[model samples]
Target: MYAVDSPPTPARSPQTPPAQHAKPVRRRSQREARVAWLLSLPTLVILIAMLAYPLYRMIVLSFQNMRLKELFSGATPPWAGFDQYTKALTDGVFWGVVGRTAAFTVVSVSLSVLAGLGIALLMRRVHSKVRIFMMVAMMFVWALPQLVAAQSFRWLTDSDFGVLNYVLTKLGLDYATHSWFVNPWEGWTVITVLVVWAGIPFLAISLSAGLTQVPKELLEAATVDGATPWQALRNITLPILKPLLTIVTTLSVIWNFGLFTQNWALRDGHPEPVYQTLATFSYTQAFGRSNYSYGSAIAVITVLLMLGVMIFYIRQMFKIGEVD
Candidate 1:
């Protein structure tokens, strides 16, 4: 049998060792990490410069008894330890402000979310031209500065020469020269309305974007199975939109809880005690009453509260990322 040297045995190409392959990957990861840190350095420095020292000073101030005397004299204020915190915690007025802020946040967030969700759903069912028109209108409103919007609302709701008063009188209602702020409920209603109106555009646009991710096939299938629109929404649409909704709702809570510019401007830069929220309360205590340390204490408490909300938001965001 002619052992014709079986076609010269093909040489095996040299294989890279696993350890050798891993070295480049480790080096690449280290390089990427260095690049990321380098890119973030500017932001880190800015935050430390702008925020870190101020936050540290504020916290320190909260532990002192800094009043107008110390402020003007530029003298170190005496430390009160936790006395400022204790006073705030025990004070009825402080509690009232906290309660009012919490209540307004709940109401405003609920109204804004519901209205935004409704408008977003409505946009989905509308014709393309109509959707475009709605978007244009909302964009204009959203693009309008908050200060401008607040000023406009203030003008509209002016007690004497307001268009609202004029229209109400024309319609046979006795709204002529009527002060909306006379009643706390009425004043809050106006504030709530302004906040909701301003917030809706953002919420509507964001929710609308999220709604686009809903599976058309699932909706059609649900329809084919005789599911009502509401049923389809509850089962399919809402479930899909829940994460986005949570994020927006949490954001609204944060924004509305702050509750400063609207109330401040509406009341003409000096919100009344009845209209006082946490932000206004802190400001009033600090500048209006010159109780700097007390204001700092309230601000510290506010930050802690906000931190809780932020933690919740961060956790939800992480969950969304995992799902994706």
Candidate 2:
């Protein structure tokens, strides 16, 4: 057998130098990293300047004996250690305010979430036009300035010459123009109403969006399997909506916990403190009484409470993600 000479082995094109091949890729990666950092720079600067600095200052101030006088006089106050914290913790009014604030948060958030869920469910079944109208109405109330709404509601609920009393009398209801601020429960009721009104829109919008994301196919399949409407909602829709619910509820807790404007406006020039939420107490300590150190202590406590709540919420969110 004549062995045909093997065709000349194809000459391999000289491989591009490894450095040449890698250079462009390394340069491109560097360029991408630079671009990402450039895009993040503004947010980083703002957070450091606005959030970090203030937090640092607050922590420093909390440990000092600083007052408005010292601040204005530019004198660095001597450190007071944990005295301020101890005082705040031991104060009767402080503890009382804490309880009131807790009650306010729980009642208002619960009512708002319940109300929002009902409204969202109703809107889901309604015509798009009607849903839009209701959404706009809720948004209008939500978008109103907090101070403006507080003042307006204060006027409406006034014991003397108030429209609420007028309407009640007109409707032949027993209407006594008693001072609402004198009664802690009545004052809380008004505060709760204002908070619920402001809060419901957020929950409604969030829950509505969540509801919209519930797959029609899943519901249909559930129905095909003889599941009731309620069963389908509980098993499928609720599970899907949990993340949104957690987000809305956590946000509502934070917002309501820091409530000050409504409580202040609702006080309406009353001399005796009626509804003293934690925020109001902090404000009273800081500006009203010029006790900056004490105010900082209260603020720090409030911050810790909020942090705890957020941590719990984050844990729940991760737990939900892990659930099958």
Candidate 3:
């Protein structure tokens, strides 16, 4: 009997059922989803009513042979397909305007960003009171309505009664009072100056914020390593500030491309269309000549160009982020 006694076998608990193991927790119900959609219906409807209709109308009008007469006579405009687009492409003035717009954007954005960076750096070192004063002055320039700024600049650069001419004369410089708006290059120069003046403040404020994020410790370390201020800015500050720079430059390009008020108020369609950007050209086509279809075509092209630029900008920004 003693030899026959054996160790007792260990008992195991039963395994969980396959259904219990595999089952998922309850999720949102169809009814709940439907309720959420119902709550969002007003925003959806408003977007369709306000945005969708206009966009659809614009696309439809762009493809039509609609003119002022057809619009007024209540006649259904004939479908033109790509005729308007072809015409726009072949137009010499369109190309000229494109070139002028590009030039203006490049010059204005370059100067504005550069000047803004300089001012932001300068402000970082100055007394708080001086910085505040400079900021106030910058805001004054920025707060001047675009039209008023354009007009004031025009008066200041006038051929006859300009302060510039007076100043040059007073300084004993042989400066002649030339017609600023008469020449194509001169007209663009004036527009560029006004744009840069209006735009630099925005860049300065934005870049200043970015500059503040740069670590003071890193800067001090660089200085202790015998790095010059310029070297520190180049090697340390700029790399940290790249994202903000990209944003500022991209926004500046977009803004300058769509610029209307400064160009319109400053030159007022002078210099035989040489100073016209896409915005002004579209306006002249739509309102000046009542060519609705043609105007829509121009607008569509401008929109496409802007879309392309934005796409590239976004791609570049993502690439920069990835690099970091």
Candidate 4:
């Protein structure tokens, strides 16, 4: 047996699965990617044509003196070389407009989000029938066109024959034939009220939807542990709702900061310089005064401000995703 024994046959290295086996999978993935791109192509094209081109044109216009003359004559606008920006930056009135816009955004968004959160919490505690009715009413308001709402508010606040003044007069507050717009403060109050009223439905509904995701079990356990409703909300429910709250808050900020319809409508399509926001201010400069390049520059700045808000929103969303 020893004489017959031979060196053990060299062990064969383990054969790898053939690389050929991966080729079809790789090809399929490539094919799927191609299909996905194809599916997205139309949307990409539309966005580029609609958003990108207009943005590019606006940017160019911001750097050029393009008034009605240039616009109508189809002539190339003279290069402005930062003059428009300088003018905007130097103008105290422009700064005032910016400040007013920021202030309104803060006040309106704060009121909206707080009121919305309260309403959402209330909805949770209400009978199902009541909840449904509230939702129906809010949905009706939300669906009402902004223009119509603004017009209705205008009518309600009208000086000569306003129901508001009539009611206040009836209550002996001496509001008979009171002009709401005489004082900028009063005008702004009306505008803010209308904006807040219009905005609440969206925020409440969205926050209510978010609240449904809060775990009943967790809330029950917290209750069992003798945690107060506030403590439970602050600790448990808020943490769950934080992401949605952030998203809605950011959107509200964006919408309120722009602030066109309510202010414009309330002011009768011609907001005074005192009531002007960035949006209306730019519009007044461009169309009302025919200072196109200056208006474009302001518009550019507005877009940048919005971009900052969007960046913050995106960062919050990313953080929320990581937490999830």
For this target, which candidate reaches the highest TM-score against the unseen true structure?
1
Best by lDDT: 1
lDDT of candidate 2 over 178-200, digit per residue (tens):
56667778777888898898888
After superposition, candidate 2 runs with Cα above 4 Å error: 1-45, 224-226, 269-274, 311-324
Global Cα lDDT for candidate 4 = 0.91
Worst 10 residues of 1 by lDDT: 315-324
* Per-candidate local distance difference test: 0.93, 0.85, 0.85, 0.91
Ordered from best to worst TM-score, the candidate numbers read 1, 4, 2, 3
lDDT of 1 at 139: 96
**Candidate 4 backbone overlaps, count:** 0
lDDT of 4 at 17: 84
Q: Kindly list the per-residue Cα lDDT of model 1 for residues 1-324, writing each as its tens digit.
A: 776666778899999999999999999877866866687689879989999989999999999999878888999999899999999999999999999999999999999999999999999999999999999999999999888888998999999889989999999999989999999999999999999999999999999999999999999999999999999999999999999999999999989999899999999998989999999999999999899999999999999989999889878875775466
Q: 1-324, model 4: which lDDT tens digit per residue?
A: 366778899989987687877988899877866866687689879989889988888889899999788889999999988999999999999999999999999998999999999999999999999999999999999999988999999999989888899899888898978999989989989999998998999999999999999999999999999999999999999998988998999999999999998889888898888899999999999889999888889999999989989899878865665456
Which one wins by lDDT: 1 or 3?
1
TM-score of every model? 0.86, 0.81, 0.80, 0.85
TM-score of 4: 0.85
Residue pairs clashing in model 2 are none
Q: Rank the candidates by lDDT, best first.
A: 1, 4, 3, 2
RMSD of candidate 3 to the true fold?
Answer: 7.2
